[model samples]
Target: MAAWNLYRHRNSDGSSKDWAVRSNSDGSITTRRGKTADSLPGVSNRYGVKQFDIERQKQAKGYVLVGEVDIDVNGNVVFPGKTSATPTQLPEPDANPMSVPAPPVEALYWTVDCHAKQTIRVELGIEVRRLIGVIQSVSDQQSKPEQDWDGWQQFIDATLNAETFELSGQIKSVHGVLPWLFLLALKAKSFKGVEIDIATETARDLSVDLKAEQDVLVFFGTDLDSIRDTAEVLGLLKPRLNLAATMSDTDDCWF
Candidate 1:
């Protein structure tokens, strides 16, 4: 016979929002605009299968969701709830914000399973072996040697052989070709700085291209999900590096 209390307001502009009632205590009220504790009790949440499907597509195209708004923790949302319900908790941010690697990133381990097509399975990771670059010889100039024949050959050999590789001293296996396919993987430290780009083709092929850098990492595959998952883990942006913002404006775009 407990009464419902205002736990938090869930609104973009802040009007009457959701509420949660506590069995004991005065109960808590939260504003859809207000800030929640950095550390809230963790809760198990699940996204609709359809939503996850959309996420896969968006990520495949190189988009990411890094911000959350109008969130409520420790609130009762279920209808006609009883007193046994527990408070919701927010996920913990990386302990060392700068040090914590991105969740999904290029050239990283990823396992993907498609519900609709059980036959679709993908595993992505870095290759442990490294290959030295070599040039390809052309028999006839009429055939016109590939623009990047050596580079391309090196790319193919490394990518195929990259079934095993190393990154940051971590040993990982490449399940198969990756989404955002790259001809090869190489260290790009030779360049002072570089911008990275991730792309997908009509054939469902994945490609990652790091520009103007001698050393780089490449992933070749058809699984767009794995490419995105890799980018998410490696912290590399599609053709760019995404910087985290500390503030935002009315449009919700971080500034």
Candidate 2:
């Protein structure tokens, strides 16, 4: 909140210059003693959070778009405003040609990361699948026809081959224990892919709901000492259990 090394260069005529710079406590440089600060307005870091709210921003900042699909002619599947589809069947020298309109279809795969220790709520949009079809004309110069089944098959192939997505968020809390443990659980789990759903419905506008369910463990402790003690006992017991050797003693085993 302090300004540093403010200066005004004076000419021999004793006129003052109009610029200044300031150093911020967070190791960030900022302009202070100049018209820039006054003209720009809202130049204070006072509204910023004291620490990073990892959970609050996790879902808000992360999303992965997997792939794109193209729409074919049953009609033009124009995004907003576009014209109608053209005829696919070609004209003949001796007979009339049949025409059909083509429609557009596509789906995009996405991964959303929710950043929060407390639960978050959100509204998700609809999910769609792409239709696959090839372009081929009876003659090389004619318009091509498409089939519904083929298009569906193409969508399947594209979605299946879509790349895997991983999303992470930084959350800040006075106590870092819960956050650290949650991260460790993610590392221990093995999943081909995961679907996460977290929500926070109340305080709609003021609070950003950032919550997600994952394949890994999610533990938040009001009582960390108890859980830590239990983990130590279990850790010691696991390696000592070898039941197969005890049961298979061939020398003189009588059970």
Model 2 lDDT per residue over 146-195, tens place: 32223223223323434332232232222222222322232223122333
Q: TM-scores, in order shown?
A: 0.18, 0.17
Error of 1 at 162 (Å): 26
Instruction: Residues 174-238, candidate 1: write the lDDT tens digits.
Output: 32332212222322111112112222221121333333211223332233333454433333335
All candidates: CA RMSD (Å):
20.9, 28.0
Tally clashing residue pairs in candidate 1.
38
Task: Give me the candidate number with maximum lDDT.
Answer: 1
Name the regions of candidate 2 deviating beyond 4 angstroms.
1-167, 194-227, 230-255
Clashes of 2: 23
RMSD of 1: 20.9
